[model samples]
Target: MAAAIMNLVRVSDPDTIVLGGGVAGSANFVERIRSYLNPKTMRFVSSARS
Candidate 1:
C-alpha cells in the first residue's frame, strides 16, 4: 500500500494526500505509510493525516 501511494505521488506530485476508508482509520496504518515515504520525495507534500 505504501509503495502504491509512493508511486502515485511520483506520478501526480500532489501537494496533499487525503486518506479515508477503513484502513485509514488506523493510526498505525497511516503512520506506517508515512514511514515508508522518503523525506526527500515528500519535501513539498503535505501529511496524509492533515
Candidate 2:
C-alpha cells in the first residue's frame, strides 16, 4: 500500500496529496509520510482536527 502511494506521488507529482482513507488519519502513518516525503512537495492534514 505504501509502495503504491509512493508510485502515485512519483508519477502524478501533485502539489498536495491527501491520504483520505482509513490509514490516512493515523499519527504514525502521517509521521511516516512526513519523514519520507520531501518537505517542499508533501503536506499532511492534521489528524487531530480531522
Candidate 2 backbone overlaps, count: 0
TM-score (C-alpha) between model 1 and the true structure: 0.70
Model 1 residue 26 lDDT score: 90
Worst 10 residues of 1 by lDDT: 41-50
lDDT of 2 at 38: 54
Best prediction by TM-score:
1
RMSD of each: 1.9, 5.1
| lDDT tens digits by residue: candidate 1, 1-50 | 87787788889887767788998889898888889888887676654443
> Residue 44, candidate 1: how far off, in angstroms?
1.9
Model 2 has an lDDT value of 0.60
Colliding pairs, model 1: none
Residue-by-residue lDDT tens digits, candidate 2, 1-50: 55566678678765655678778879887777657655544344222233
The Cα RMSD of model 1 versus the native structure comes to 1.9
